[model samples]
Target: MLRLGSPRRRINIGLIGMTFVLSIFAGRLIQMQGLDTKVYETAAANQRTQIEEIPAQRGSITDVNGHELAVTVEAREVAIDPSKVPAAVRQKIAAILGRQLGKSEQEMAAKLAKDRTRYQLLARDVDPVVATRLLQAGVPALSTKKTYRRLYPAGDLAGSLIGFVGDEGNGLGGMEQAKNTLLAGRDGKQRVETGRDGQQIPMTSSQRTEPVNGQDVRLTIDRDIQWAAQRSIAEQVRKSGAESGTVIVMDVQTAQVVAMANAPELNLNDWRRAPAASYVNKAAADVFEPGSTNKVITAAAALEAKAVTPDTVYQVPDNIRCADQVLRDAHAHKVESMTFRQAMAQSSNVATVMAAREIGSQRLHTMLKAFGFGSAPGGGVPGAEAGLLPDYKKWSGSQNCTVAYGQGVSVTALQMASVYQTIANGGVKIEPQIVAGTTDTSGRYVPAAAGKRTKVVSETTAKEIATMLESAVGVEGTGQLAAIPGYRVAGKTGTANRYDAELGRYEGYTASFVGFAPADQPRLVVLSVLQKPKNGHFGGQLAAPVFKDVMTFAIKSRKIPPTGSAAPQVRMRAGQ
Candidate 1:
């Protein structure tokens, strides 16, 4: 039916077709091995290579004595390669993980059931010991990653001051937040090739970058003093049934805050469970009417301006009228001629107002500013507030007189303590400092600059006021309970009406006592404050005792010997 092709022709055509197909295959091989080699190789390398982050260790936070307060310790991240785990053992592995990691069995089971994935994170920040036990269980595909966890060795000691870190290893508050940049070092990276089984190929070419650990922060806080302050404040707060309390102790010469304690302190190890209020460093952050404690400022202004002497007589009455307001003394008494020292010792509102008139409002306001009021105390403390102080020109007639006796104004405990520190240090006001210095990654110590000092009053004025303050702690004075055995104490007691911002009205009282020990040669200043105490509300009764206890411990701990000089005689009444 048809002519058949020659056998040679058929063979030649078959060979030609085979050769064309073979040529295509050869070209593809050449392209992959040469022209497009890098593209293909990169694709393969990306699949087999993994880049892991190397966490840099956070720096340590230590007390002045090198006591470790906050530190970073070795930890692990537990994970699983679901693809390597057998289906039968998935449930068993989930059971072990749940028991150790505190996760629900159902949750771990769901994670382990992901057979298509190579990695599933189980838990992070696991203790190394616990992670080792997990790996020892012999579960396939379970692995532990090297990591770090923040540890607070001192527990809640100086918790609010040292602050805490977040899950991302960043500081959130306190000195930790203020100096976070120095505390968080640079992280590094590592790249290594792995086999299909997700195991690192030994001896393979890999790149690694070394991490730079954070710098250590050394604070000026004395650990023993901080502990004592916390203990005393916490005990008194509970005993007095107060809403809150704060205590601050400062080195008079250096203005270094040895101890700053607040009641209901936040525990650094368990910060997440604490209330929001506990996170506040109340000593520096909270502001309130300083009451009679503010009288010291008035006294400083009057004495400095030469408006009144310690023996200047004032006919103090039970009540006095200024503008549209009538101000009364804390106690009811008939008109009496009293020396300026006696009026101050008795905390007579009438006498203070009468004395304030001698200097007028302008001189008084100037003295307040000079004493560091209406300004933030810069000591590297986070959330340190500048208490409110209105201008003297804006003062109403009543405010003029009220402000003279520690009303119509607000101040932080730290600022008030600084005022006394100025007097204690012979009129030189030094900025309060909490951070002593920082230790760098290279292990070199870098000290912070000394606090800025400004002279507020002459040494003569300071000494004279110091003697008057001593008389206030005498038997007839309101601050009698503030006296320590074998030590001449000088301080003022305050009981101001609390102004509740929420209610927009005045309610309750802020009882406080601020003073320094060894009146003739003050070395340390201690201030104790309580807000709205339900049990007792007098500064002498509630706050003064706390001051005496804390000061006693601080002086003894620092080995500050009392000055041998006896207290000079201060006339309370006009006639001796």
Candidate 2:
């Protein structure tokens, strides 16, 4: 204490230390405000600017008459800014939102408790009106985003045909999946400047890329006909206790699909509840033997090749032998002398086999290919299968005879209907079509390109088959149940042994009826199919009634009057 320094020296030392500290701070300020100025400015801009994605509206699906099947409606996504919400009031606000949005209070509270997060989703796909009412509560940090949600207005009317969308708004099945690209438009983007509170800064620079909305798809389906077909098939499937069923109706002249219906169909609005198999359009997807319905092809091949005529006599017994197997008719009968027309009208398997032999294996195979078998039917339908048709060269000895009677070969309901449509169209086969066209950006309707056309047989051969089909619907024929009063009808019934893949054997029968109305001037073709029927397994008994109900409504709905021409007389028996 006695040897202290002078006052001037102490004062000078303190000033020097103060000057050093001030110089260090000055240098740091120069570096930050001048040398790294651009860096700091960029960081500030990044904090204020925000980018957002804008979802595009999905397109609509409509029937031929402008009925909505699938549509998009305005919706909102409710969210919260957890970081901005006060901890004391978080639970209260969450409870209010939970009640209004149908969410659990605890879940909403947990989302609100994420204090570090700026955004937390409360609910997606909320109704706009509900969202508006939710905001009227004036809860702090609550927000709503504009969005769109899919709606199936017709319920399950065309559920499987129209299909459903996923959570991300992508098509999942049916026409929705087949034409997804055209239906799902491109999304857009937007960039805007915001303030510290996360609110957009007014009058600030903003950037946006406009979204391209999806185009509307129009189908050839008639709503009324589709309803009738679906109702009738569903009822028949239940009454017959079958595993499944299908019905298809087409315009003979245009080859346009008027109605496609399946039992146990998917409900578009609630598709998750349905089984996966029900999601398929079975009419165009399922494959099975056509049984007697396929005899028309043999008849066509024989008539076209001049192998046999309608009056050709056959001494048919109840059964015939081929290779190691013996085939029999539907019912046991003694050897009978019948003309070709009578054999057809009676659904004689033996007679069909004899005619197939006249045409030979190669000629019959050629005729099958010409009729659109063993090929995928492209009609803008999803899961359209190319039915199985083994080459004649690959046919086993038994298969040759079996294929002649529609055993070894397989075909879809649509393919079989197309065959009848070809006959009804005077022998010209047109590719079946479901989609009529799509609307342009300007909202103008544009028709699709015409389907491919091929001449399958001569007009004369078609007329001969038509007459033969008419005999099958006559009073004495197996398909008499399919006849309509005052209308000339032509049809064939099918009852085939159903091959059960799961059981690894033939367990039941596939009953089907394919036919056309106004036989003199065909206008419509209808096909009905029932698989694994427990109550009954005859096509004429099980499937024909469904065809009759659907066909009667179709003719009446289309206002198709009878041709009023008398049916031509034909020889049923050889000596008649």
Candidate 3:
């Protein structure tokens, strides 16, 4: 304020003020370096470090014979940094990528025009060889990431069973959906310091967690047998002009499902192209009336209740009144007295109803439940249906008689196969198994738990019923087409009228045949069903030959020796 000095003194004062400003700046720098050093270091590390995920390797799915059904193959994803491409070369780059990736030049150019986007996907699931070619093209902005794509080497052979995965690498159907958790392993993370170019910096601190590969899943399905079943069913369905078909082959002793095939199947490698209905597993999902094939249940119930023997005589006619309903034999016949065995071999509806009437409602219902009907197979099969079975208490007078001849009751093809499996297994019901088990990291197989077993009928009654079935497949009976040369076959044919909901009445039929070969010592139970056949509607005419073809292949493929004995003869006439 009292500045009465020269200009040099004023300059000295200005210099002192400048020194104070410099001292304040030095104090601030010291505080930042010492007191707030951790804050700045954290910000710097965050800017230069990144956490990346490492995908786990998915496991393979194989048949019982070790044939690869589904596998994960190495693939690549091609991406580009739009901002990294120079404007002068952008057009040329887009053209080159368009040609390599099978895309239009305009589309590639539009993607490259987004300069603000650092990363843009050019192609996904590119074959490794093709990705290598694109990488070698010397495009600076282009980059590739390692990935995996699922492949089905067997194509649509077991597509419905093996199932497919979604774009996000998750299971979408069949065993894929059922065993997703076991097949998809946990992913890992890695923290890495990066450079300005987004490359891993050398000698930088890092942390990593290793990924665990998924466990392999092995199924009980046999490749050759499955193919045989599929081919046979497809040929039969198409040749017969049927809507669809299902074939199931089960091991008689172990109840292991060797082959489950459906016709008009979708290709697993391209499931999206197929119709939605093709996704269903009809063998386990759909249900149909057993028709004459259910006659076996009536016989078993009668035999179990000690109401009749295999040779018990009954006077059956062309038609008989059962409560308020009239049940008729498949063919026109005169009134004749026939033994229960002869009646069964002839598939006589009147005879079966007469036998069931002796067993009554309670015992018949018990036998049906014991045969694994009215309940799901319950081996963890997805979409398994517990077919319709009204309680005995809910049975009307006609319902009992109609159910006796397989009119009112319904069952899945698998359940029907299991019913015969119980008979083939000496009246012991064993649950069917599809998945054998998962494989360990060391490639060791761990078998699945044994299936549940329960006794449904005495061994003697089962053999007696088996003998009756063999007679049905004999030259004199209705199922003569089911007999195999050199091996006595035991089975029954069924032709059930399919109800038309729109018309509210029966319009079409489901022709089916379930049988086991080498009648003396049953080994395999094969069941085939065709829906709405235009060529032939009888199970013996349409479904039996398919069953025979599949069974012949199964017998030879399994190396099952013949019984070396003729089928047991049963008298078809009143007096033989």
Per-candidate TM-scores read 0.95, 0.94, 0.93
RMSD of each: 2.1, 2.3, 2.6
Model 3 agreement with the true structure over 1-576: per-residue lDDT tens digits: 785769898899999999999999988888888888999999999999999887777788899977899998888889999999999999999999899888899989999999999999998778888888888989877888777888999999878878888878888988888888888777778999998778899999999998887788989899999999999999999999998999999999989999999998769978989998888888888888878889898999999889999888899888988678777888999898999988988888889989988978899999999898899998766678999898989998888888887888889999999999999889999998998888877768899997999999999999999999998898767788888888889999998887655688887899999989878799999999998899989999999998999999999999999978876555656666
lDDT (10s digit) by residue, model 2, range 476-543:
78999999998999999999999988998988999999999999899999999999999999999999
Residue pairs with colliding backbones in model 3 are: none
lDDT of each: 0.91, 0.91, 0.88
Candidate 3 residue runs with Cα over 4 Å from true position? 1-28, 86-91, 102-107, 500-505
lDDT of 1 by residue, 1-576 (tens): 998879999999999999999999999999999899999999998888999889999999999888999999999999988988888888888889999998999999999888898899998889999999988989788889899999999899989989999988899999889888899898899999999776899988789999899999999999999999999988999999998999999999999999999997889989999998888888889999999999888998999989899899998899999999999998999999999989989999999999999999999999999999899989787789999899999998899999988889999999999999999999999999999999876889899889999999989889888888898899879999999988989999999999988889998999999999889888999999999898989999999999999999999999988787788766778768
Candidate 1 residues lying further than 4 Å off, grouped into runs, are 2-22, 102-107, 113-118
lDDT, ranked from best to worst: 1, 2, 3
